[model samples]
Target: MSKIRITKEFSFEMAHALRNYDGPCRNIHGHSYKLFVTIIGEPKQDDADPKNGMLMDFGALKKLVNTEIVDKYDHSVVVYKNDERLPEMQKLFENIIIEAKQPTCENLVSDFASTINTRLPDNLSVFSIKLYETATSYAEWYASDNPTE
Candidate 1:
């Protein structure tokens, strides 16, 4: 069977701040984020299978991404885990994500890719991810650009 690529789009609200940057983004800010995930795989070949002719069910993908990314990050404030302000921020905000890396769009997209890659069914693989921090700006990650060893 020929390989096929399927994509799904998701949106969420999130806030973040760069710890030591010398720009407006250094302060806490938020964006209505848009995320697109693409998966590549061969459709199920068994005609008797309910999922036959499908690479993967859209609902399954939605549940996976929602559980791993969307549901957790939506309406949440994300900051570097080691940010000095973390202690104070935790006290003030109930929904905070202490990420290991800076919560920039670039890093977030890469993190999303890693998450999907690890959790996807064995027959499917993440092909790419594009994350939009603004209507006019976005970052993308492609599996082809970072082949696993």
Candidate 2:
């Protein structure tokens, strides 16, 4: 039993903040967020050909992220809490449904990882998600059996 992992990078710009934060981050700010989605699994038997034994197809992965995730946040202002604009987000959600705990990159990464994991083929499992809010700032989340305290 062998496992292979594949990652795809994506980016989108949006505005958000830590609601009620006592720090500067409390103010709404925008970031050109970068996302790294990792998928792991054993090779597909149907694609046993030497060149394409992996469970994932790069093109399919791209399509899943692009259509299901990136395209939704392209130029939207992401809010931590519900707002009047939620109706609009609701519309988009109808199609792609990318929602988060809060609009922060960390939360975004967690939400994305969970959502993608649910959408992936049964054999493919999501391992981790890394989100970069800026060149120097980022966060990571993984599927863990033990929750962090």
lDDT agreement with native, every candidate: 0.94, 0.73
- In model 1, the runs with Cα more than 4 Å from the true position are none
lDDT of 2 at 13: 78
Compared with the true structure, what per-residue lDDT tens digits does model 2 show for residues 44-145?
A: 766557546767888889899888778887766666554445566556544323344556676777777777877899888787888898988998988763
Extract clashing residue pairs from model 1.
none
Judge candidate 2 against the unseen true structure and give its global Cα lDDT, from 0 to 1: 0.73
lDDT score of residue 97 within candidate 2: 31
lDDT of 1 at 108: 94
RMSD of each: 0.9, 4.7
Candidate 1 total steric clashes = 0
lDDT for position 73 in model 1: 96
Residue 91 lDDT in candidate 2:
65
For model 2, state the Cα shift of residue 52 in Å.
3.9
Q: Would you estimate the TM-scores of all the predictions?
A: 0.97, 0.78
Which 10 successive residues of model 1 have the least lDDT summed? 140-149
